[model samples]
Target chain A: MFGLIGKMRAARGQRDAVIDVLRETTGALPGCLSYIVATDPADADAIWVTEVWTDQASHKASLQLPQVQAAIAKARPFIAGFEFQVETHPVGGVGLPASEKS
Target chain B: MFGLIGKMRAARGQRDAVIDVLRETTGALPGCLSYIVATDPADADAIWVTEVWTDQASHKASLQLPQVQAAIAKARPFIAGFEFQVETHPVGGVGLPASEKS
Candidate 1:
């Protein structure tokens, strides 16, 4: 499995708007096991997003999906900057596929 | 619920060692609902850790736990530097509490 952990900063006073856009994209992603959009407790203009994909290819494919592309475009104006994006190999977790004991 | 998404760089070539230490600390956390630790597919010296705790207080209290404190001490040598640490509020998701649809 594949995972992504990142921090996205929204344009001033646009945190909620950015989050709403992200929320709309969840589940709509094929091959995605889990997609979480969360509010940053510390930074008012930040959102923390975590995604679990079946594989790196699926995650890559998601970017080309019309909906995802639309979301990226729609969300662009509200994005201020990204703090960091880290890739990860997901072993197993709750609400994720391959949950059997490892 | 409270959430944390961050990337930790392993000292030099200690990625696997750091991951093993983190794995040992997971379930040992009382209020933690889920903790997913993964290797960074892009960076050889990085590890991505996503955590879900019952509440901010719970997460805070965890740091006071002897086991956690020990783990932190034990894992410190293997850690290089943190890329970014973002706090989050988790509403609902699979294997998480309060999963009923909104």
Candidate 2:
């Protein structure tokens, strides 16, 4: 599976705004297995996003969806920068679709 | 929910070995919502572990499980270091249990 793990630094105290924008884009996406938005405990201004998709194309496709695009635009000002963006190949794990649980 | 996102750097040429040890501990952990071990595409010697649990206590308890302890010991030699160990409070997302999806 295709996966992405990254850290997003929010502008000053705007972490919650960034998270809200991300959460707004969370439903009915094709091929999305998991997409979690979380608060980083160590850095009050940082948020972490973890995503898993069926394949690379599916992830790319989601970026083009209007809602996602809108959410990105809405979050831009609140986002200071992104760090540690790592792409991954998920081998197997719990919470994945049965077929992906190998 | 309790969550953790971390990067584990493996000794040169031992990334897969570290991954193997982690994969062996994947099943039947109570309260574990998601536990994914993925290969980092940008760094050959690094891996990312993303996890979500029912609560912090469950995560701590899992560390004491024989299989988890064994896996940690087995993977230690292959692991060079760890970085970006962030604790998070997961809000909502796909692939989380139904009760967790907000």
Candidate 3:
């Protein structure tokens, strides 16, 4: 599976608004196995995004989805910067189905 | 529930060795709900770790475990540097149980 971990810095005092866009945009991706957005405890203006997709192609394809594009448009103003981004090859874990392992 | 998304950069050629240690260290913690160690597709020297724990306290407690301590020591030499680390308060998602949501 394709995995991703990235950090985003929201505008000061706008973390919640950023997450609302994230929550709304996540599931619209067809191959997404899981998409989680979480608030950073240490950084008041940061959030971490974790994603598991069926494969690299699927993840690439997701960027073209209109919903994802819309979410990006909505969230852009709230984003201060990208802290870091990493693409990963997921092995497996709890919560993800066994099929996700391949 | 607590969620953590972090990225670590391994020594130039040591990402796999580091993950071997990570895989061994995870789940030894009592409150670990999920632990995934994935290799970065973009950077051969990077790895992303995604974790779900029962709570912050449990995650703190795990660091004191003998196994975890050993794993840290063993893996320390292979670490190049940390890219980013973010502590998150997780809501709920596909693999995670609904009970995890507070």
Which candidate should be chosen as best, given TM-score against the real structure? 2
lDDT of 2 by residue, B11-100 (tens): 999998888888778778988999998887778888889999989999999999999999898988999999768799888888888987
Q: Which ten residues in a row have the lowest lDDT in candidate 3 chain A?
A: A93-102
lDDT at B77 for candidate 3?
100
Return the lDDT, model 2, position B89: 88
The DockQ leader among the candidates is: 2
Q: What is the C-alpha lDDT profile of model 1 across B1-102, one tens digit per residue?
A: 888877789999998887777777766477777777777767899887788887889889989988889989999999989986767886554435444323
Better of 1 and 2 by TM-score: 2
Q: Estimate, for each residue in A1-102, the C-alpha lDDT of model 2 and write its tens digit.
A: 899988889999999998888877877799999899888777899888999999999999999999999998999999999976879988777788897776
Query: What is the i-RMS of every prediction?
Result: 2.5, 1.1, 2.2
Task: Report the alpha-carbon TM-score of model 2 versus the true structure.
Answer: 0.90
Output the TM-score of candidate 3: 0.77
DockQ for candidate 3:
0.49
TM-score of each: 0.76, 0.90, 0.77
TM-score order of candidates, top first: 2, 3, 1
| Model 1 agreement with the true structure over A6-62: per-residue lDDT tens digits | 778999999878877777776557777777777777778877778777788999999
Q: In what order do the candidates fall by lDDT, top score first?
A: 2, 3, 1
TM-score of the B chain in each candidate versus the native B chain: 0.91, 0.94, 0.92
